[model samples]
Target chain A: MNYVLENIPERALKPREKGLTMVMDKGLSLREVEDVLETSGDYIDIVKLGWATSYVYPKLEEKIKIYKDAGISVYFGGTLFEAFVVRNQFDDYRRVLDKFGLELAEVSDGSLEMPHDIKCQYIRQLSEQVTVLSEVGSKDAEKIIPPYKWIQLMTDELSAGAWKVIGEARESGNVGLFRSSGEVRTGLVDEILTQIPYEKIIWEAPQKAQQVWFIKLMGSNVNLGNIAPNEVIPLETIRLGLRGDTFDHFLNNEWK
Target chain B: MNYVLENIPERALKPREKGLTMVMDKGLSLREVEDVLETSGDYIDIVKLGWATSYVYPKLEEKIKIYKDAGISVYFGGTLFEAFVVRNQFDDYRRVLDKFGLELAEVSDGSLEMPHDIKCQYIRQLSEQVTVLSEVGSKDAEKIIPPYKWIQLMTDELSAGAWKVIGEARESGNVGLFRSSGEVRTGLVDEILTQIPYEKIIWEAPQKAQQVWFIKLMGSNVNLGNIAPNEVIPLETIRLGLRGDTFDHFLNNEWK
Candidate 1:
């Protein structure tokens, strides 16, 4: 079940802090979920039920149990939280999470306009019960928050007891740190990195080039989120310097 | 089960010749495979067992049965044929196909070096036994065949009784008709279109933008290949002009 690439740096197994890989599950069947966990379970640290998809499936509890039994942390997407908040059902959302035994929660205002103080209060409330991974960025490409604002939000969220802050790239890897063509805006990434603790930030890099760019810029242990389930092993390969892009990078350096 | 976008043009269901979508299955569990078929089965016409991944998985027979039962055509990737050819096991390959009850096959020289005559011979051989889909273009980006040569090969394969010719894009979508950035080489695509019947060509467009571009360039009925399992519904949305990209495209046009 070892997904570590050969002739490259090895990563620590489950319960790992560094080199954590979070897979985006857009409604996979229970058996298929188990198959992926059986094959590449060691490499997966967290599984996020992708955007508004968790509510569509009827077997949510069973799916969550399968993921939890495999020692993988499970959480719903930030959009689902936004949906709950919009409906004024925060307590109902918490009850549902408790019933499903999901200990990891993602809090964000990506799809809604919520006040900064209100958002921070929710983060602090969730942090006392579960791992609170707050996200900073607007989901709509046209309504993207300024980079400095994003930095300020990340800093504030961390100060408000959020375990880690995620940078939103959505599923397409088009907005936020990436251009419409999916290329990383190096200057923006550099500006954000300078203001935040690299270890406490997770970049949602859903594309190969974006993953490679983040790995090269932030080194191998950079936390990446929103990875597709199928691309889990491929991302691990890039992280461990087994893929072509990093293979060349490591070969050129020959030291680290 | 209907994945058709309500706002856009509707496509013909299973057994469709035009606007056909062929998904690439690297390795999926029975439940995972069934879940995809349940959601987007109507949009998918074929499911290709990508490369030699079929050989690595333990339950090939069960997987094929599930796809077939869903009324979806199932076939092995062209790379598997190249692997059998390399080992001089074409007879064994045919036997394995019979045992699994596969009715479609792909013949290609993507991985192995083979002349046009040999490639066509395999196409003819497969066509007599099963529905043959030949693929043109090399897997290695550095060794890309010219557009004119691709035109000639695709024409020859069709003449050899192949049902359709797929232009290779691999899973990464970076090595064939696409650039390193995954953008389609528009001029090259147009050059190839000039020499081949549009209906007979199935472009491997794994990326969302590429899918949108192909649908726009070739119209909604253009046959596309190498689509990931999860993207079946999204690709259908693009083809029907339901998604934002195509929605905007159609909104600008007056005629339906």
Candidate 2:
């Protein structure tokens, strides 16, 4: 099924390096997951079982199979990893991932406070076993790390063998790069972008306005995470410049 | 399966009144709708097929059957009625509703410029045939009617035999009794409440914060509309004082 907006640029299909869209699965049923993939599968590259929701869903295996069948990479949210780490069940976590056929893993100290060296070590260790994605920044707004520290953390994680470093924005786009009003802190985004390689980072932008801001600032190829399942088509429209937000940005651009 | 907060302010199950939660369905698949209903079916009173999406979805009968099986009332959005009225196919729209087993309908003049008398006439006409819910405000924020006019519209619609009058907030909470920041325009809400019966109004609040504000300002039994399918449980939690926002509010009181 060809999407209506096929003329726009930077919309690489599956196995894409640029314009990657990651969806957040917050306790969707197996059939719901299948229906989502059937309708908007082409636009999604990765699916993150959001926060601690993976522990709640009864039929996790069935849900994983549905996503796998649709050629979408599935991974647990960073908070889930923090839960495992806090419980001292990292080995058990790896075993569960292997059993469930999950190829990707997120390593972050979003909830649980962990030292930078320890965080980097896990990133390196996980990279040897599976594709590792490490996240920077705390979930709590009060404990927000400076932009320089975030850039440094991104560098350390990438060096330690993380496939991509994620900037935490949580489920609500109120904290981390965003203010209480959901607007991106422009200076913070600029400072982080100046130090970090944009290609190796996936920014957690859960809102439409946030997605539009990032796409406008970093181009359509900017990797985005925590997208709602239903918003996949709308996000794709924004990425391809079909949506009003980024239409002018890519209208005259050429696709590789 | 019993939910975690089952004991909290036990709402009337399916086919309910008073504490009604009407979800806005904007082109969701059959499986997606079923998944949402499975988890939060008990809380949902009505599901509005948002805007013109009902006319666009494939296998409309199958979708309606799924909602009916879950014991939920399915209705088309008011915009569809306006569309039908524009095309001079009101009879055809009624026949389609009967064919699809839809029991509820919305009569509104949000999109088109219909006279107040004509709108009230349609509400009376629709009330005779089906469960008619008349909406009071326009979709465009710039074209919003004053508080006095809204109160008059609500009173007129209810007098014309409509079940409930819904205030237009569109999908985004911004623009109608809500500021550009999605905060409730307190002055406007207060003015409208003074003129209209609280029991007769169903405020369309699509955002979680907006839902929280309504539950906090107007008690647990406040009627709300345009809720997302997944948010049904969360909204119920807030209404019942199970979530942190309301838990802090009601737990300190004698209600706990």
Candidate 3:
């Protein structure tokens, strides 16, 4: 960034809508959060307290405050929502969100089974209080939702007041949206994109190869989520074709 | 660490003769280094600025100071040594170590072809300048060294004055000591231990499953290298058998 390079694709600025980068905070210490903010805060849009780590991560409020103070949105991972919902504590979950002063919430059934209508209802209800990001895939590798089901679920969630539909791949990037071998379900993604706008979805791409695949497919401004804190700079480089993987992808790209 | 847990194996404290944890710093900002030291300093014995990253990583002096201040030894990655040696800048490399106030150095032939005797001679020279950690193995996954050869190399490196001989896995944990799939070459490791003392060899096990494999095989006191910055806590938990992977391994472990 200190030196300008020709042929580098333009990346969307912070507060990005289409080229959003949502990072996964898997129990980072306060100092670590400070370091992340200092180093890669501008590149990051949202920070998800990955899975149920927020439930056990000490100083959750402080960590969230760090992100929020940096003008970055912070939300608990979708699994926490399911954890509360499965325990019949939806109200408590809302109150917990309020307690954390969060302006965003995730609705997901990645780890639990819920009726589609009920899932939509929860999305609609949370949308009133905070921006909702409803995840549309199951975490179980054995449970493969077809492309049609994915499109239907994403469309329904968006209609249910969800701001964005998250494509689940878990933190490992090896389930939902990706095969167990970490290969992208190319056909399923291509099918889902037919119905769901790329801007209304955040693909969980924790691996560099997957990030490259998505960038090649969706250009520099694709919405990506579940990125590790350390990878923000590397991902930005990939997006702008500064890294080897996408160095040639953006030479003549006009996807800014 | 805040609370005592039953069935936890006794882990050797720092300044330890064994149970060494060598972390890999692949271009962390100075603030990030502070966070790592604050969070996992006690568990980390040495940190390698991963694979020539120190060449481009800004504020190299300050970053090393942070680790040194925390009573932890820091060394440039073995690949950097290969880079310097290949360029015939061996003396310049030695000067750089002194300039950075590094008390440790690594000698490795992972990235290039070097006669075993010549590699040992470099190790002998570096051993006089600083504590040398000579790595043995090919970075090329296809260049397989038999189990006996692994032992021979490791034994010769240790004999040549390396404080510890590191088994190559190249951060990805998919070469050298491990298979391309990141599985430990159990037979190779078993063979190596037959001739080389496990205490003198630092197995590069960066992956969790690989870490679990080593912990189970060598008990809680295995010397592990190339650990990611964030995995230090998880690795410590595995060593203590507090994590699920080795929860039962050390529950009745007599080796601890």
lDDT of 1 by residue, A1-256 (tens): 3463345665666687867888988767676797889777888899998765665454677888888888999998886676566656688778767877779999987766778988999999988889999998876677756678889999999999999999888888988777778888787778898899788998999999999999988778888998988898898878878888898765555577
List runs of model 1 lying over 4 Å from the truth.
A1-27, A30-168, A177-256, B1-6, B242-245, B253-256
Error of 2 at A217 (Å): 13
Model 1, position A206, has a per-residue lDDT of: 96
Enumerate residue pairs that collide in model 1: none
TM-score of each: 0.60, 0.61, 0.61
The TM-score that candidate 2 achieves is: 0.61
Model 2 misplaced stretches (Cα beyond 4 Å): A1-23, A32-48, A51-167, A172-174, A179-256, B1-12, B29-40, B52-58, B83-100, B112-118, B172-175, B179-183, B195-199, B219-221, B229-256
Question: Which of the predicted structures, 1 or 3, would earn the higher DockQ when compared with the native?
Answer: 3
Please write out the lDDT profile of model 2 over residues B1-256, one tens digit for every residue.
2113213455554456777898998988876787787666767888898988977789788988888888888899999999999999998988888888777899999888999899889988877788899997777878857778877888888999899899888899887767777888777788889978776789999998899898888878888999998777557656765443455454432210
Q: Model 2 over residues A48-99: C-alpha lDDT tens digits?
A: 9876555545567788888898899999877666555655667877877788
lDDT of each residue in B148-171, candidate 3, tens digit only: 888888888888999988998976
Instruction: For candidate 1, write residues B47-164 as lDDT tens digits.
Output: 9999889889999999999998889999988889999999999999998888888899999889878988988998888888899999988888888677788888888999998999
lDDT of 1: 0.82
Q: Pull out the clashing pairs in model 3.
A: none
Clashing pairs in 2: none
